[model samples]
Target chain A: MTYCVGLLVNAGMVLLSDTRTNAGLDNIATYRKMFVFEDPGERVITILTAGSLSVTQTTIARLKDAVRGPDVDAETSIMLAPTLLRVAEIIGNTLAAVRADVDEKLVAMGQGVSASMIVAGQRRGGEMRMFLIYPEGNFIEATEDTPFLQIGEHKYGKPILDRVVTPATSLADAQKAVLLSMDSTLRSNLSVGMPLDLAVIERDACRVTLRRRIEAGDPGFRAMSDAWSKALRDGFAQITL
Target chain B: MTYCVGLLVNAGMVLLSDTRTNAGLDNIATYRKMFVFEDPGERVITILTAGSLSVTQTTIARLKDAVRGPDVDAETSIMLAPTLLRVAEIIGNTLAAVRADVDEKLVAMGQGVSASMIVAGQRRGGEMRMFLIYPEGNFIEATEDTPFLQIGEHKYGKPILDRVVTPATSLADAQKAVLLSMDSTLRSNLSVGMPLDLAVIERDACRVTLRRRIEAGDPGFRAMSDAWSKALRDGFAQITL
Candidate 1:
């Protein structure tokens, strides 16, 4: 189980993901689920994954291979794709292929593997876009009315995002919104653990403006979490039932 | 798809349930999910159900039959049970039996049915008790550390309960907590809908002290929901990144 969120606002895009991965409760491991590919001022693509680790890792590895291949083309490589939509198509196809390949081996045991990802990025002239890619190779984009996309263990963290996020929200507030969303998830679920990866892309920058790895006990994250909890408690106490 | 919660605080017990039930997204209808049986000032038992409509409705019907049966005894009837635990056992066993009967008929269709329930009440001279009865007849009681039990579409409503509910929480506050919790679920899920059933049982009263049916346009519930949303938004705005 994992929790990853991608938010696209007028100011920029914010991506947050937890590092915990588990085949079962007893076999838990920490794995980075966020991948960044960039050509600086030309283009920047950040991928946040959740679900079967094998499928996600293999799909990402394949995408990386395509980027480094000598015959790199827009059709085969996300980095060279002409638009964010094309990039999403390439990643989605790769993810679906990898999942199918993995599922075949697990089928005999009545098991199957699958994964989904959030693709957030921009090209120099293309508008910033965020997509939620399904395991079957299809995707849905974030729209002005609904500026956020979440994958895996999403329900616990969703109420806050539904209440606070909007297309016109500032980049700083978007960061806070995603972090607090993750906080709610972490407290409610054990499978989503600490040491999170956070990335912020300023609009039209074509590069990540802020990157953070929040480890357990990190003072800043801890302070923000504590403050949010206190504020909620105070707010709750004030409500006249 | 339903949302039902039972909370036990020092002051008493509170039970809340959404009236929505659905066979699928296209086949939704309103159905009561909360049932109360009380021998006033002696014993009171409130059951909040969730899951397969067929299974839950059947289980409740059977329990009611046993209560009104001429051969009623502690072994077969919840109302005649010697203790709150005994009542839970009767309910759990009946639920499991009904589920097994229903599952058998659905198995040929490659489908199965199951349901769960939260039973809360106190018997004369017995301690107040709350139990979450699983489909297989097993049950777990809510304790001081976790004074609440929820069934069906629970995650969306859990964070608030986690933060606000405790054994020492006042009855009035507990009512607010459960209502706000339901408010969150109602907003996040389409399957959980309006016309909620709320029941409060004050300590030692052994009967429902307050009961209300909150329709879709109920003014008091609307005001509380609106105030809670505002409080949450304000709290989110005050948090710093």
Candidate 2:
């Protein structure tokens, strides 16, 4: 299982994903899921994926292949897609194609492969839009009322985000919201593990302003975990029957 | 969709379930999900179910029928069950039977229906026990590591419990933990709606000590909602990336 969250805020976008994948409990492995496509000042599009590693890894390989291809164009790849929507379209097409191919092979063993991604970023002039792409290739955009989207072992982490995240939230705070969100799930579920990838794209910067990898024993994460525990205990105490 | 939580703390057991049912987004309605069977001071059992209403309601009806029968016995009923575990076994078998019957009818239409419940309470002279009954009649108890069980739209509210709950948590604190847990899910999920049934059973009481139904505009719930929103905003501001 994996947990990936993408938030579109007035200050920027925050993307976080855990790197644990498994065919089963005993087959667990760490595999990073955040993919960044950047032309530095020109554009910075980040994709955080969850679900089948086969589908996401292959889809990402194809995206990278397109980026390196000499004939890359608005119609052919995310690198030159001209708009975030077009970039999403390009990614959706690539992901769907990869899924179809892998699923066909897995059908012999009665297995099905599926994957989804949160695509978010800023271009030289366009707005920082965020999208939650579905396995079927359709997508939903994050609006003011609900400024974030999450995938994978989502339930355990969703509460904090639902209560706190907003478009007007600061870039730094948004990162904390996602981390605390992920922290919640990590404690409840064994399928989701550590070595998290976190990226912050400041509004209109057209580049990732900050990137972090939080490991199992990171001090900052440890502090946040401890603080949250104290807060929950206090909150419970203050409530009346 | 539903959100029901059952907690087994040292103080006792707390069972809470939201009363909302929806066949589709446009066809939502309120339906109680909690059913209590108590020969007060003797045996007190409460079931909070989630999933297909048809299956769950039917199962509860059968159990009620057995309890009301004059020939009730361990072989034929829950009222005469030898132990709390036996009562759980009876409930699980009946729930499974109901699910199979409803699922068979729905199979022709390609629709699926199944349900699960959190059964918690104590029999006089017996230790308090809690079990999460699955659609297949299999169940697991709440251990020290996981002192609570939540069914239906569980993810949205799981963060708080992960951060704070333990078996030693006081009953008062556990109650607040669960309400906050449900509050998070209610905000994020439209399918899981309002008017919650909350029951508190102090350990060894063998009877409910407190119970209340929270409606959409319930004063206490409204106050908690506002306070939580403020605390989350404050918490976000206090944290750094």
Candidate 3:
């Protein structure tokens, strides 16, 4: 299990993902689930993955290969795609293909492999956009009405996002909202663990503006989590029935 | 679908439940999911249910019939049971039997019906207790370490309960916590809807101390929900990350 969220606000896009992966309770391991492809001021693409590790890893590997291979073209390479929508389409199609291949191998065991991803990026002279790519290769883009997309272990952390996030939220505030949302999920679900990957892409910059890896016992994250908990408790104490 | 929660605190027990039931999105109806069997000061047992309607309704009907039957006994009637633990056992067995019967009928459709329940009650001179009964008739009691139990569409409402609930929490505060929790669920899930039933049982009293049904437009509930949203936003704004 994993928890990855991408928020698109007026200022920029904020993306965060946990690193824990488990075959079972006893087989837990840390694996980075956030991938970035960027060409400085020209274009930037970030992908956050969740679900069967084999399918996600293979899909990402193929996408990277398409970007590096000699036969790279706009149709095959997400990095070469002319627009954010085309990039999403390429990633979705690649993810769907990889999932189907993996599911075939697992069919005899009455099992299937699938994965979903959050795609956020912008190309020079193109609009910034965010999308949630489904395992079936279809996707939904974030709009002004609901400018956040989340995949995997999403419910425990959703209320805070629902209450606090909007299209007009500033970049700094958006970062705070996603981290606090992840904090709630971490407390309630053991499957979603640290360290975490967080990236911010300023609107129209076509590059990742700020990126950080938050680890367990990281002082700043710990302080924020503890402070948020205290504030919630205080707020709860003051509410009358 | 339904959302039901039971919180056991030093001051008392608080139970809240939504009344929405649906076979499909277009076939929605209102059905009470909370049942109470009380002998006043002698004993009081409240059951909050979730999952397949047929199984839960039939199980509750049979329990009521046993209590009203001519040959009522400790082994057959929950009201006559010697301890709260025994009452839970009786309910668990009845639920398991009813589920098995229902599952057999649905087997041809390759579907199996199941239900879960939260049982909270106390008997005169006995300890207060709450049990989460699984479809298989097994149950785990709420303890000091974790004094709340939730069933059905539970994740959206869990973070607040995890942060604020404790054995030392006051009954008034407990009610607020559960209602706020339900408020979060209502905002996130269309399946869990309006007209909620709330009940409070004070410690050692063995009877419901306060009971109310909050309709969609109830002024008091509306005010509390609005205030909570405001407090949370204010709290989020004040936090520096």
Candidate 4:
């Protein structure tokens, strides 16, 4: 299980993901789920993935392979894609293909391959966009009405997003909403752990602007956690019979 | 879809359930999921059901029938159960049997029946206990660690419970936690809808002491909802990037 959320706000875009991946309760491991592709100053794309580590790691490795390969056309590559939509399509196709291959090999043991991703970014002159790419080579764009996308262990964190998020929100506020959302998830679910990966992309910048890693004992996060605990206690106290 | 939650605290047991039932997006209706059986001062058992409405309604109806019959016994009754544990066992066995019977008729269409329930109450001179009963006649008792149980649209509302709830929480506070939790689910899931039934049984009282129905236009609920929205917005503003 994992938790990844991406919000497209008027000022910029905020993306956050937990690094924990567990095959079982005793087999938990930390693995970065955020991937960035940058042709700096021209285009910058970030992919946050969730699900089976094998499928996620393989799909990302393949995408990196495409980036380092020859400058193929859009039909043959993700880097040459003209738009974010096309980039998402390419990612979805690759993810689906990787899943199919892995699933086939695992068939003997009756295993399965499952993975999904949040793909968001901007081209030099194109608008900042976000999408949720499914494992079946399909995707849905986040529009003004929704403005955000979440994947994996999503339900536990969804309430905060529903109550506080909107497209008109500022990038700074969006960052807190997402981090708090991730905090709520990490508290309730054992499969989602710390050492989170957070990234911010200012609209049309075509480069990563803000990036931070929140470790287990980070003071800022610790303060936020304590504040939330206090707020909940106070809030509960104020409610009447 | 449904959303039902129960909290066992030192002050009492609080049970809340939404009355919405849906076969699909196009087919939704109002169907009460909370059933209370009490012989005041002797025993009180509130069962909050989720999953197959047919299975749950039938199970409750059967239990009612047995209680109303003169031949009541531990082998065929809920009202005569010796302890809250036995009461939960009776409900679980009934749910599994009802599910199996309903499933038999739907097997040709490849459909199935299933139900889960939260049983919370006390028998005279016994402790206030809570059990989350599964469709297979198996159940788990709530501990100080978990403290509460939720069924149906659970994910959307779990964060708040994980944060502020505890075995020492007051009954009134538990009600608020559950109502806010249900409100969170209502916003995110259209399948879970209005007209909630709330029941409170004081610890060792052996019967439901208070009950309320919050309709769609209930003023008190509306006020609480608005206040919660404002609190979330304020919280978002108070946090720095």
DockQ numbers for every candidate? Answer: 0.83, 0.58, 0.84, 0.63
If both were scored by DockQ, which would come out higher, candidate 1 or candidate 3?
A: 3
Candidate 2's displacement at residue B25, Å, is 1.6
Stretches of candidate 4 off by over 4 Å are: A239-241
- Provide the global lDDT of candidate 3 against the true structure: 0.95
**Mind giving the per-residue lDDT tens digits that candidate 1 earns over B1-241?**
9899999999999999999988779988999999999889999999999999889889999999999989888898888888888899999999999999999999999998889999999988888999999999999999999999999999999999999899999999999999999999999899999999999999989999999999999899999888888888888788777
Q: Which candidate has the top score in lDDT? A: 3
The CA lDDT at B151 in model 3 is 97
Give per-residue CA lDDT, model 3, range B1-241, as digits (tens).
8999999999889999999999999999999999999989999999999999999999999999999999998898999988888888999999999999999998999999889999999999998999999999999999999999999999999999999999999999999999999999999999999999999999999999889999999999999999999888998898898
The local distance difference test score of each candidate is 0.93, 0.87, 0.95, 0.88
State the TM-score of candidate 3 restricted to chain B. Answer: 0.99
The TM-score of candidate 2's chain A against the true chain A comes to 0.98
**What are the per-residue Cα lDDT tens digits for candidate 1 across A1-241?**
9999999999999999999999789999999999999998889999999999999999999999999999888889888888899999999999999999999999999998879999999999999999999999999999999999999999999999988899999998999999999999999999999999999999999999999999999999999999888988888898888
Give me the overall lDDT of model 4: 0.88
Order of candidate numbers by lDDT, starting with the best: 3, 1, 4, 2
Pairs with steric clashes in candidate 3: none
**Pairs that clash in candidate 2:** A155-B155
- Candidate order by DockQ, decreasing, is 3, 1, 4, 2
What are the per-residue Cα lDDT tens digits for candidate 4 across A1-241?
Answer: 9999999988889999999998889998999999999888898999999998889899999888887776656764667798888898889999999999999999999888899999998999899999999989799988888989999999888888887888888888888889889988988899999999999999878888998999999999888877766766665566554
- Backbone atom clashes (below 3 Å) for every candidate: 0, 1, 0, 0
Order the candidates by TM-score, highest first — what do you get? 1, 3, 4, 2
Please state the Cα-based DockQ of model 2 relative to the true two-chain complex: 0.58
Expressed as tens digits, the lDDT of each residue in B6-26 for candidate 4 is 998878889999999988878
